[model samples]
Target: MPRKRYAEDLSVEELRLLLIEKQRARRQKRLEHFRRSGRLVVVDDHPTQPPLETLASRPLSEETPPATANPKHTRLDRLLLAIEILAVLGLAFVLLNGFTLIRDLNREVVAMINQPTLTPTPAITAIVLPGGHTPPNSPGGPRPNDAEIPEHLRPVMLSLPELPTPTPSVEQAIRIQIPAIKVDAPVVQGDGWEQLKKGVGQRLGTPNPGQRGNIVLSAHNDIFGEIFRDLDKLKPGDQVILYSNQRAYVYIVQQTQIVEPTRVEVMAPTQEPIVTLISCYPYMVDNQRIVVTARLQE
Candidate 1:
């Protein structure tokens, strides 16, 4: 048998003649098939045959139906789309974490400033002289019993003179002077973001000047004036002078450390009067905190 040719390969005249012959042959075959099966076929009395010119007049539409997409390519495209969505979500999560970290750091600073101060009642001190004269709370009076004196009170009674803790009605921190680090900024009674914007903030609930407890003063290292920018330069024996209550309370730097922000122990109370200065670590990137601890000079 000869190889069959498609409509695209046939001329207009040939295609037209071929279709007419094929239609007649199809009718004859249908008639013979129905007779063999003994089935009566109903034929139209006036069969309206379509015009043969239509075959050559209008070429078969070249616009074929679209082919189905490949399953492998479709699956690969879907996987790529899923990966892109996941990447976008991951980027959003990281940005959210960064924002949260900055916000929480600011909130922590503000909370430290707004915290209420807990005032301790003045301790009663009754001392007896050599002549059995009981003086009313005289710090200068000679203490008799060395064994009876509390460890905290021993230094004040024997060597260092008693320095009274300042009791200001309102929270007021005048000035902070760290000559070693070249820091001489006005002090404010807050560690809040807004307060720190003005100057260094003194944390509430800490000891006052000359008091026998930890005095925490914290400020920003990179932003909001960067008051404690050179705080890391401070070392042992460096003097940190805080002028308040018309008196200068000098503190000798004992040690400096870089600690996590969650380390609240750095701000805990102490038996002896001390000063703790805190700032964000690593210069511009504030991921950790730098703490400088100092004790009051006698």
Candidate 2:
């Protein structure tokens, strides 16, 4: 065989012609071999690649693959989308249930804790003498001798008109203002979540402001506008004003304390007119309570 020529020995035009000739010969040989073996079903005499126009015009359904996506792939995409939606809904459902359960548990714990620790203070009916002293035993003092009172005044007292019983109003708290902490918020009736969410809440059955017993009020420290968020900042002698039925009742802070949530003695009744404010301890945690007690400033 003659000596083979290396690609580096050929000029640019010569190298191009040589490659074209080699490719043409290879194609011719392949066609003849396939023909002689009776394996060729179609033949093309083109010496170069088919034109773009010819390829584009060919029937895609028969000669080329379909352009539309596979049916199985489409179904898989739809399934994946549905699963993602389901996952999001499930997560939301779980979160809602968790919040409800937590609220219910908290309410239960509060009910159990506040199971009437001390007896309510009894109403006082006393007759004070001019010297400001009470005589004999408590609750049933002896009747003074008739010489002490004029005979004419005693008959007048016996014939005194019976005063009508005042009707109790169903109004809830209207407003609250704490001067020291600069808190002014509307007050709601119940200590439930809905009421607290609006503002401060007054526990049902607790004495109203200016009343003789304890006036129990509570709010969240970290939520519901954080009306009592700065409760711990208050010192004794601060003033809190609660408005009800268009009347304002002022209270002077007496003490502040932190106790476990189970300690319900803070809500007990007292003979003196007082107000109690309760909030969760440490800002965001409900592990303890911050109790702030104030007495009505007559």
Candidate 3:
């Protein structure tokens, strides 16, 4: 009631010492309270947990987790799953299409073999030529039924036979004179019948004088600009005479074609007899072949 004078009312150095003592007393009181309420926690220099004083500062609701579940991880997960599914589908589709194409090609080859073509086709005349005697209606033949012939049957060579037996030559076979076609080049019987022979084909066989299969005879039309000089002038009705052995063999022109050199199938032998003469096409290009199909007449 009167003026109080204790450490609390003293100077700063004395007040700090007094505050420490007061804090110790208050901590003892709290320990007593906790022990009585069965909430006492053991104290050690390095305690397993922080003092209850620190925990008391935070709200109980905040310290603990919420009642709801956690949010999920997504977005990139969905994109990756979709990409995997699409890749599987694309691979399946490609395999299915590839198998289908192979089956179709095999079917086409089988169908080709099954279809028989013995008689000459008027439209496709090289495989089997127009047969029998040329009527009077036919060009270069005697008067017969010239006007009555169908337009499609205008001109065709008779089918070729297997390679004919080499007849005795009236002169050397080396000197083949095709008077109708007027090709007076000497016949050189070898792989090189002509200068362009070496690099033009796949099959390089031993060329016998009288042999079966297609006989490919090639020459440059512009050799010194005079070889096959008369080849382009040949008409369908014109003739190509091969003088071989003692007998002279005659060939009538059937079909003429200008095609890329890659089409080597033209050199394949036909069921019928055929002679194919080939040379570079056009005025200056060597990429295409000018093919002429002919058959022996006599």
Give candidate 1 regions above 4 Å deviation.
1-172
Model 3 lDDT per residue over 1-298, tens place:
8898975579875564455557657977997898789898666645465444554444546655776743343667777899999999999999999999999999999999999977653233233111112222335642222233345545532342223334434542344444555676655443222323322211233122234446556655443333454566666756765555566656678888877544556766665545676665554433355778777564
TM-score of 2: 0.44
Better-scoring candidate (lDDT), 1 or 3 = 1
Q: 11, model 2: CA deviation in Å?
A: 99
Q: Deviation in angstroms for 230 in model 1?
A: 1.2
- Tens-place lDDT per residue, model 2, 35-87, is 88999866546557765445445554544466988899999999999999999
C-alpha RMSD by candidate, in order: 22.9, 25.2, 20.7
Error of 1 at 152 (Å): 38
What's the ranking of the predictions by TM-score, best on top? Answer: 2, 1, 3
* lDDT for 55 (candidate 2): 45
Q: How many pairs collide in each candidate, listed in order?
A: 0, 0, 9
**Residue-wise lDDT of candidate 1 within 1-298, one digit each (tens)?**
9998988999977876787668668977987798679895557745676566654464544324568899999999999999999999999999999999999999999999899987665332211101111121336532222443346755554553333444564334588999987888887675645566678777656667888888888877665566787888988999999887568888999999987654656776678999899887667455567889999999
lDDT of 1 at 149: 39
